[model samples]
Target: MAGRGGTQGKSGDEVVERGGERDAGGGGMEGWKRKGKRSPDSSLRHVFPTPSAFPLFLHMAGSEYGRTARDVLVACLALWSVTSLVVIAVWRTSPGVRSMERCKAELHRARGRLEEARAEWGRRREELQDLLRKSAQNQTHLRRQADQLTQSLRNSDASVSRCLQGRLTYSISRYLVF
Candidate 1:
C-alpha cells in the first residue's frame, strides 16, 4: 500500500514514488508501470506518471462525506417542500381571503342595487316632468275661462244700469207735467 502524499513534476510526466511494496518488475509507481522489459532504475520509468492526488481524495471522501452531504441536502429539500405545502394550505383557509371574497360578493350586489335605483329614479323623474307639464296646461286653460266669465259679467252690468236710468227719467217728467 502506498502512503497518501506524493509529489508530481511540472510536466505531469514525473512522480516521486512513496513508501509502497515494489513489484518484482519494479512498477514505475503505485498504479503506473514502465513499458517493455526495462530496468527498474531506467529513465523510461518516468514516461507515464502516477495518478494525481485530487482524484484520489475525491474517491476516498465519496464513501463517508458524500453520503452525509446527500442526506442533508435531501432533508433540506423535503423540509422546503413541506413548508411550502403548509403555507399554501394556510393561505387557502385564512379568514382574510374569505372576507375578501364576501366583500366582493357584497360589492357586486350593491352595484346591482344601485343600478336599479338609478333606473327607477330616472322613470320617476320623467313621470314628474309629465305631470308638471299637464298641470301647467290645465292652469292656462282655467285662466282663459276665468277671463271670459269676467268679460261677460261686465257687459251684463252695463245693460242693467242703462235700463234703470231710462225708467227713472220717464217717471220724473210725468210728475212734473202733473
Candidate 2:
C-alpha cells in the first residue's frame, strides 16, 4: 500500500509540473510575438519623422542672422533690468513681505523676553537652594541641642533617686532603735 501511494504522488506532481510549464511558455511567447510584429515600424516612424513648423521657427530664432555680440549683450542687460524692476515692485507691494518683517521683530522681542525669564529663574533657583541649605543646618543644630538636654535630664533623675534612697534608710534605722 505504501508503494502504491508513492507512485500516485509522483504522477500527480508530474502533471502539475507539466501544466505550469505550458502556461508560462504560452504567456511569454504570445507577448513576444505581439511586440515583435509592431516594434520595428513604430520605432522607425518615430525616429525619422519630418520636421514641423515649430521646429523651423525655433531654428531661425536660435541662429544669429546679423546681430553683433554687443547687441546681444545690450538685449540681455535690458531683460535683466526689467526683471529686477518687476521683482522689486512685487516685494514692495506684497503683504507677505510686511508680515515677514513684523514676524521677525516679534521673534526678536520674544527671544529677549525669554532670556530675561531664564535669568530670573536662575536667580530664584539659587535663592531657594541657599534657603534649603540654611534650613538643613538649623535642623541639625536643633537635633544636637535636644540630645544634650536629654542627657542632662537623665543625670538629674539618677541623682534624685539616690538622695531619696539614702533618706529612707536613715529613717528606718532610727525607728528600729526606738
Candidate 3:
C-alpha cells in the first residue's frame, strides 16, 4: 500500500523514500544492508527509468535488471581497456615516432663528434703556430752565426796576406847582400 508521499506499505512492511534514498523498515543504509537485498527499483535507476525502457529486455525483477547493468558495465570497461592498449601500442610502434627518436639520438651523437673534432682542430692549430714561431727564431739565429763567421774569415785572410808580403821583401834583401 502506498502512503502519503515517500512511505509505502509492502506486505505490512514499511519502506520509506527520502531524497532518492530508500529505508526498508529498519533504520537507513544499515537496515538496508542487514536485509542483504538492494531495492531493485533504485539499483539501476540512473541507467533505466523503468523496466519497460530497457532494450530487448523483458519485465524483470530489480535484481535481474541490476545484473544486466553490471554485465554491461563490465563489458564497457573491458572494451575501453582494449582500445586504450591498442592506442598505446600503435603510438609506441609508429614509424614516425621511432624515426623521430632515432633522428634525435643521431643528432646528439653528431653534435658531440663535431665538438670533439673542433677541439682537435684548435689544438693542432696552436701546435702548428708554436712550431712555426720556433722555426723562425732558429732560422734567424743560424743566419746571424753565419754572418759572424764570414766576417772573421775575411779579417784573417787580410792579416795573413800582409805577413807573407813582409817576409818576401826581407828574404830578397838578404840574397842581394850575399
Candidate 4:
C-alpha cells in the first residue's frame, strides 16, 4: 500500500535478506521456530547445530589440511565472499531489474496523483476568477447608479426639484441596499 521501498511488498512468500540475519520474527541465536532447523516434532538431538560446525571445521583444518583455525576460517570466508559475489552478480540481472521495474511503476503512480492535483487546482483557480469577475461587475453597476443619482439631484429644475429630490432619495436608498 505504501511506496515501493516502503511497500514491504514482496511478490513471493520467501523470506529474503541482503546479507542481514533475519528469522522472520526473531534471530538465529533464539533458534528458528518456523522453518529450517525448527519444525514440529523436531529436536536438537537430531540436529547438528551450526555452532558445532566451527569446531568440526577447526578439527579438519588442524588435521591433514595443515591449516590453522584462522587460516581455515579465512579460506572459508574468502570462498564464501567470492561465491556470494558471483551469485549476486548473476542474480542481479533478474532481481535488480524487477526492483527497478517496481520503482518505475511507483513513480508513474505518484506522477499521476501529482497531475490530478495540479488539474484540480487549476480548475478551482478558474472558478474563483469567474466568481471574482461577477462580483466586480455587480459593484461597478452599483457605483454607476450612485453617481447618476448625485448628478441628477444637483442639476434638476427648481419646479420639480422636490420630486427629483424625493426620487433621488429613493434611488439612493435602493443603492444603499445590497
TM-score each candidate. Answer: 0.57, 0.46, 0.51, 0.31
Q: Count the backbone clashes (under 3 Å) in each candidate.
A: 0, 0, 0, 0
Deviating ranges (above 4 Å) for candidate 1: 1-62, 166-178
- In model 3, how many backbone clashes occur? 0
Candidate ranking (TM-score, best to worst): 1, 3, 2, 4
| Candidate 4 off by > 4 Å | 1-102, 149-178
Candidate 1 lDDT tens digits, 28-119: 33344442332223453254355574334333333345447757887999999999999999998899999999999999999999999999
Residue clash pairs of candidate 4: none
Better of 1 and 2 by lDDT: 1
| Residue 101, model 4: Cα distance from true site in angstroms | 4.3
Highest TM-score scorer? 1
Could you give candidate 4's per-residue lDDT for residues 1-178 as a string of tens digits? 2111111213433322212334445543243344343322124324445676643443343233424655778899999999999988888778778899899999999999999999999999999999999999999999999889877866665548888788999999999995
The alpha-carbon lDDT assigned to residue 57 of candidate 3 equals 32
**Candidate whose lDDT is highest:** 3
lDDT of 2 by residue, 105-167 (tens): 999999999999999999999999999999999999999999999998888888888988889
Better of 2 and 4 by TM-score: 2
Worst 10 residues of 4 by lDDT: 1-10
Better of 3 and 4 by lDDT: 3
Would you give me the overall lDDT of model 3?
A: 0.67
Give the alpha carbon lDDT tens digit for every residue of 2-37 in model 3.
222243345544443433334444543355457664
